[model samples]
Target chain A: MPYVNIKVTREGVTREQKAALIAGVTELLLQVLGKSPALTHVVIEEVELDNWGLGGLSVTAFREQNR
Target chain B: MPYVNIKVTREGVTREQKAALIAGVTELLLQVLGKSPALTHVVIEEVELDNWGLGGLSVTAFREQNR
Candidate 1:
């Protein structure tokens, strides 16, 4: 059994969207990895925008710098 | 970015085992899903023995029932 955790920026996503995303990912895992959905576990966490970083830059800063 | 969460019975697993499990699962995802490790985020949570249930039975009870 594989357990998966998902963390995302909560600002742009709705509760329904989050649920759909989880379900979609779960399906993807089953379809792609040949794993059983019932045996898999998924958890979602929403983190603050400022806390997320990419390439040593905060997501906010990365967006601004790229823009 | 695909974020994966892993929840496991932490009782029998050591800290090193946990880290290895994460790395193994992460590698499995990358190898199986063609995803970038940098883009994937994984979180591991250890739940109490009483909290995890499988097939409508708690892990503890399931083991007992099976045995």
Candidate 2:
């Protein structure tokens, strides 16, 4: 069983986009690893800007400083 | 930064239970990997019984057969 978890800053993700992500990730796994889709699990988690950080700065603050 | 994706067979999981899971997972990462909580991402995905399988049998079918 292959379990894939996708995390993206929750800014403007739409339902359709999520659907596409789920399909695409599953397809990629099947192609690369020959894993069965029936046992493949793709989960997307939307992180709050404040909760996600890079280089020791939260995405929210980083975006603000850049702007 | 550490990203964690938790996939569990979706059956009778409550919102409170999920919250506890998120918190526990985050804490575990911090203790083991010394990852920061601010940048740690934890997402829980609940898989349908039909979508999760073991030994080529879907969880739904496996449960039924065992029952």
Query: Using lDDT as the measure, which candidate wins?
Result: 2
Model 1 lDDT per residue over B1-67, tens place: 4566766554665677656655665565565445477877767677776678778888789879889
lDDT of 2 by residue, B15-45 (tens): 9999998899889988998988899998887
Interface RMSD of each: 7.1, 6.7
Pairs of residues clashing in candidate 1: A3-B5, A4-B4, A4-B5, A5-B4, A5-B5
Residue A56 Cα positional deviation in candidate 2, in Å, after optimal superposition:
1.5
Against the true structure, what is model 1's DockQ? 0.22
Candidate 1, residue B48: the lDDT equals 71
TM-score of chain A of 2: 0.94
User: For candidate 1, lDDT tens digit of each residue in A8-29?
Assistant: 5655666776566556656655
Best by DockQ: 1
Which residue pairs come into collision in candidate 2?
none
Q: In model 1, which runs have C-alpha deviations exceeding 4 angstroms?
A: A28-40, B7-38, B41-61
